[model samples]
Target: MDIDTESTATSLDENTENFCDNPTRDTIAEGLMGLIKPTVDQLDERVRATRLSQVELRQCIEGLSEELKRISEDQKHSIDLEVYLKKLINAKQRVTVLSNILQSAQERLNRVHMSIDKETVKRKVLLNNTIEDPHSVVLSKNIGSSMSLQTPLYNLNDFPDVYEPSEDTHLFIDALEKDMKYIINSKPTLACEIGCGSGVLIAALAKILKSTCCYFCTDINPKACIATTRTAKMNKVPLECTRMDLTTNLKCKFDIVLFNPPYVLTEELEIFGCGLNRAFAGGLRGRSVTDRLLNNLNDILSDNGVCYLLLLKENNIGEIGEKMGEKGFKIKLVIQRKIPGEHLFVYKFSKA
Candidate 1:
């Protein structure tokens, strides 16, 4: 046992050396493991956070996509509404235009109806009565009578602005011719013609009567007054012409009053000026100018005065006669003539 103790000590020394080397290696391995484990734990936490952020980003993108889809739908609806509103506005404008056109058409139709009714009445009257032709009557009387054939003294070129004598003028003169005997018998002291266009009617009256009665003529148109004066001068008739409005300035009453007036139906706006248009622009069924004259008849006429008024068939002669009757005046249809598309009449009014 004593001789083996050295060998045993050598074995123990070898065992201790081995144990020390192993502890050194184990300590280094444990330190490396500590550092590596902390780094690995931090990396794992970062990865988890990145995954959570990715999930949130995906949710936010889907929400934005849904919002965009709703906005697109809303914009489409707004565009549709705008288009519908424009169409409605256009339709309203078209309706307004059509209403105006319809109103104009209705007015025209009413005028036509009136004309047709008038023509029908005239045709019936012609069938019932042996109405003499006015032109033939005038010609026959002229041929047999000693009275000279009266014509317009003023030439058309003399007063271009004055209303030229037309068929109406001839009709008026013919009517006067038919009533010549009555007029001569009445012995008018003062004769006046309202709205004397070319002084033809007054001039003829002066020539027919051949009496020394005062003859006066009035016209709103200054050119007409001048033409009237010129016509009287040319015809060697003693005529006094005045530029006045329908006996407005005259104080003396007339024994006889003559008015041709503007007997064509027209709008009031067309009768504004004292031009040639005023000669024929009778407003509202051709009675605007005539009604004024009728209302003022009592004031301007003498006790035994006679008013000769020219009127169209459309003027409603029955209504006019009634109105005159109410004014204490008797009305007589002295003469009537039917021309193409129109009927003309001369009404004689005198105090009852």
Candidate 2:
């Protein structure tokens, strides 16, 4: 019985020791797992939330990228529009310049056409007339009358640079014709024409007088000098033409002085140059060139000299007459005619 009781005690002791050791280890491991498992689950939840936030952030970035791309395209379109607008403006300027150029070309062409028409008319007149002499022709105011006046020989083509004879020229000739008897009675020794364009007036005077009286002409244009010589030779008249500014440096006084000055109002810049501008461009009320001649008239004229000046109404004829009166001169309106928009007049001035 004693041995049996001892064996039972030993076995019970071994069983208790094994049970305590194994069960304690298992309880400790289970407790550690329970605490760790909850912590790991919390960490896993936080990680999932972080991943969701990352996905939302990535979506937001993609949306912003789309917005930026749209903005970039819009900016690019605006730039293109600006470029097109600038090009359009440039094109408009170019078109304006071309238009002005075309207008100027048209004006020049019209002038050329008018010149050609004038030449044609002159040729037709010459052909129609039965001229006794090719160099000259007797012009009769009364048809079928033996009493006739001779005209200076002139070809329009010979004086291209000279101002063509217009109504003013004819009007001046008519005035001279009306006073031809008086002029012949005066028996002038010297006669001069200022701004003699075609030498028609002086040559006509020489023809009518048929005298050995000296004829002098002065012109600003050098071409006019050549034209005057040609006209005088063609008409068998003696004439001395000098390229000068209205009798500058001429020491002789004249009994008869004629001037057909530029009577068209124009810019000051257009006055006092070569070409047709010098013929027609009278600065400021068409008095620039005329005033200079008037200022020096008394010095250039003889005591009994007569000055026949052609003037437009725009030349302030009243003012010119008043100024001439102050200079001990009398003004007489020899002839006046109105044609188109202008009224032209020839005034004879003599010492009072």
Candidate 3:
């Protein structure tokens, strides 16, 4: 009963080869799966952070508004001066809350990116080894990857620019950019964005203009300025960020001047500490900062320059335009949007 020994040897060889291939495939799949898990976990953490902060920040802003009202009424009479001071002190706590919200949001975003980097590196290793189906593996890895890894308008880390598109801020930025596209295409030169919150629109403008002779960016908040700097760097847009309030005169002359002032009106009085109040609360009708910015805008813009300004309709856009008209400025309606729960008009005005 002599078996066909050569045939038996060939069958064993084929079986061994099949066994090796199956294990190799399994190893590749396992490595890819491992790489995806951490990134997904990290992304979930970021989404949670963003949601929590959004709620917290809104609450802080509302609290600050109430405190402002109390302080305003207190200052009307001389007897309540001491009480006013105490209220001012309490407002500082609200500012702290706002800061914490921003910090949390930032930390969560960082964690997501870190996780993405680690997973990407590991996935690449697996992909390289599985050359027989590298493309499919890469596609699978990407589908399973968890991270808000979309290329932002710019790099937030390097640009330090704030690009908060949610709520009223989004309306302000989107409208301003649309109107300016015409001028940006016609005249490509130096431009400056004042109070560049998140720098979302500035980055868009930079992308449009392509070659700017000089781009100056300013924000009164140190954090915002830093963010703007990072955003500019991330987008590869050349710009300088400075801490400057619109009430003060700016040194450089720009062909284009853009600003979106905090138009929310609050009655809080703080001599030295403006806090989060300065960021958004416009006085009585939310036009305090807008008025000041408009008053000083003429000083910063070139004689032949055009300026694009953002103001909420609730903040008295019509009244603002009337005042600018009296100042010998020509106003053009750039964009008007009635967003649910928000009302604003972005105008393009030039001194005549």
Candidate 4:
């Protein structure tokens, strides 16, 4: 506290004359300052501690705010993950459903295609009946030929395991028709056919010589054997069938042999494989099955047995003739036909 000049003068006058000689005003002021100094220092220390505590509290508040923000972000991220998983599940289910629907649609389309094919065939048959003789059929011709080799959809539906007669089969029948007179002249007692699909070949022979000859056929497929028997019954011909691989187990000496082999080029493994492949899967150069038969032709034939077989252009006819010539057999091409995607020939083999 600052003292007024008048107050200091009065105080100095009231003090002892000896104190006045020592500057009493200055001494009192110094004493008062000394008494208040410790309290001032204590107040200063308290202020500093309060500021430090405030700073620490502010820092702690800031850390808590940061922690709350992190928790909020984590919550948001967890929600996002849950939504993503849900979307993935939904998409997967949709894709699976679509796949099943597409598969069903494809199956329906195939059925529609089959129905259309059958309808078309039926219409054609009706049209043919109107134009030609009503007694004649779409699958057969009786214009002086020994057999009608035309095929319709019935063969496929009736016998799925059996080969459906096509161009090769027709060509084979035409070849036999051309050589029918020669076959009759020979007057064979026993006739056998190898791999007689649909039994058309043997049935044709049986019809012409039913009384004089015994007709027999061998087929790798039981369905073909059944087809042969059925064909014989239809044409009023007597025929017997045995399930054998290219005359492998025949006990009779056949005077006439007919073969319409699988002549399409394919893998060797498919030569004897299951299904329709056995009908048309000719191995390398389309000669595996044909060659095997040719190798044993000498033993398979009788003294005057004549064998007729169908061959493809890929089967190397020159090599076949040379090989047959070596085995004392004469090979003559009876009939040839070019149809669609194939060039085919029916050859006659006779002992020289």
Mind sharing the TM-score for model 2? 0.60
After superposition on all C-alphas, the RMSD of every candidate to the true structure, in Å, is 18.9, 16.2, 38.3, 19.0
Question: Which lDDT tens digits does candidate 1 get at residues 13-71?
Answer: 99989987797788998999998999999999999999999999999999999999999
Ranking by TM-score: 2, 1, 4, 3
Number of the top candidate by TM-score?
A: 2
How accurate locally, in lDDT, is each candidate? 0.80, 0.80, 0.67, 0.77
TM-score, predicted candidate 3 vs. hidden true structure: 0.54
- Model 3: ten consecutive residues of lowest lDDT: 147-156
Q: Tens digits of per-residue lDDT for model 2 on 227-303?
A: 88888888888888999999887999999999988877665677867776687767767789999999999988899
Off by over 4 Å in 1: 1-149
Q: After TM-score superposition, what is the CA distance of residue 50 in candidate 3 from its true location, in Å?
A: 74
Local distance difference test, candidate 3:
0.67
For candidate 3, write residues 52-73 as lDDT tens digits.
9999999999999999999999
Better of 1 and 4 by TM-score: 1
Candidate 1 matches the true fold with a TM-score of 0.59
**How many clashes in each candidate?**
0, 0, 21, 0
Ten contiguous residues minimizing lDDT sum, candidate 2: 92-101
Per-candidate TM-scores read 0.59, 0.60, 0.54, 0.57
lDDT of 1: 0.80
